[model samples]
Target: MTGSGIHLPMQSIEAQHLAELVEQFLELLRDTEIGEDAALNRLTPVVYPEDADASAEFADATSADLLDRRAADARVVQAGLVALGEGPDAPQQELSLAGSEVDPWLRTLASLRLVIASRLGIEADPSPDPDDPRLGVYEWLGYRLDLLVDAADELDGV
Candidate 1:
């Protein structure tokens, strides 16, 4: 399972959890109004932090296009997740995703992690207090994201 591809052996519960995560992410992508959601704001940050006018102008000009692209990508990832979740009867199964599938999967995972991190107020601190449950979830998402990224990079010969 250590190569340029993903070969994950997951239980039915794991697949269900992944599907739920992707569904939630897709809802956030499709339902949230731009500029109103804190998580979306974090996902799509201002281009020019020092200049309010410039940042606003940039956002106004590009937000629609950017959101459109994200929503489209989310749809693709949703379909993939749904397909992965089909075989619930199997107690144990190995799900394999090729390099072609990895790109969008990586993006979706990263976006989900970003939303979770934003909600959890995760920052540069590597050692967040374990007392907060959200922090633990955020850290786990980061770890998963990193694994996907590494696999994608290996596939791309990076």
Candidate 2:
């Protein structure tokens, strides 16, 4: 690992999966402009839940900006992911996450997990159906998020 940030050497399969997920996530963010689907709604949560008026006002004022920031963050992570991909079907090589990318990566991973969780109904039920294929994806995202947290902590000398 470099002194600047995380130096994760993910297997090609893992890296490819992550790249695909991120691309899907970026699509979700773009789709938010038309309307808020369940997954997008989960991603940008309401700050003011108690008051309907306040929540609408808040969403009107900040929802676009929040999503914009998220898209920007996703873009940062995407930039790093380009090197990880070998080709359409080829295996990816190692990846080096520079210090500037740590926060964006952390956010992007969380966003992806949230979207997957929303789709899998994981958020509604603490324990979703283990038999479900998407459950594996949800769990995998959590594992990746955990690794990013640990790496960021190490990078920060925490």
Candidate 3:
């Protein structure tokens, strides 16, 4: 699957799980406070690690715009997921998304993964146990995001 040629097996249990993950991601976006949520803080990293003043200034100027874009991406992702889940034959069908849709989906998936990874404190853990449930979810999200990116790259001839 490449370009606008992505085809997801809707009838599979994996597809259903992906839809549920999207829903959960949207819910997290809805509940998060742009600058207040610890999970979201990962989205806006420090611009000047050694200079608190400069970093704060940079963050103050750019955080809102970044969060706004992320929120919009989340909405797009939610709409796409909802559309996929609708209709009587949706489950037993193959859902195809256009090339244009792929970008936002990719961004949203990356954002969701960031949030989950941050919340799970995976970044700070030097060696997380693979058996941990949170690590499992984080790994799953990374795998799905990788698949999307690979598909997009093939489509773009990258």
Candidate 2 residue 32 Cα shift, in angstroms, is: 3.4
Which of 2 and 3 is ahead in TM-score? 2
Query: 41 in model 1: Cα distance from truth in Å?
Result: 0.2
Cα lDDT of model 3 by residue, 77-144, tens digit: 66766676674553476656677778777887788778777877768674666666877777877887
lDDT of 3 at 46: 87
Q: Where is model 1 more than 4 Å wrong at Cα?
A: 1-5, 124-129
Per-candidate Cα lDDT values, in order, are: 0.72, 0.80, 0.73
Q: Is candidate 1 or candidate 3 better by TM-score?
A: 1
List TM-score per model, in order: 0.80, 0.88, 0.80
lDDT per residue, candidate 1, 12-107, as tens digits? 666677678777877887888887788888777889999999999999988878767766666766676566677556877766676566767777
Highest-lDDT candidate: 2
lDDT of 1 at 72: 67
Model 3 spans > 4 angstroms off: 1-5, 10-20, 27-31, 87-92
Candidate 1: C-alpha lDDT? 0.72
- Each candidate structure's count of clashing pairs: 0, 0, 1
The local lDDT score (0 to 100) that residue 49 gets in candidate 1 is 94
RMSD of each: 3.4, 2.8, 3.0
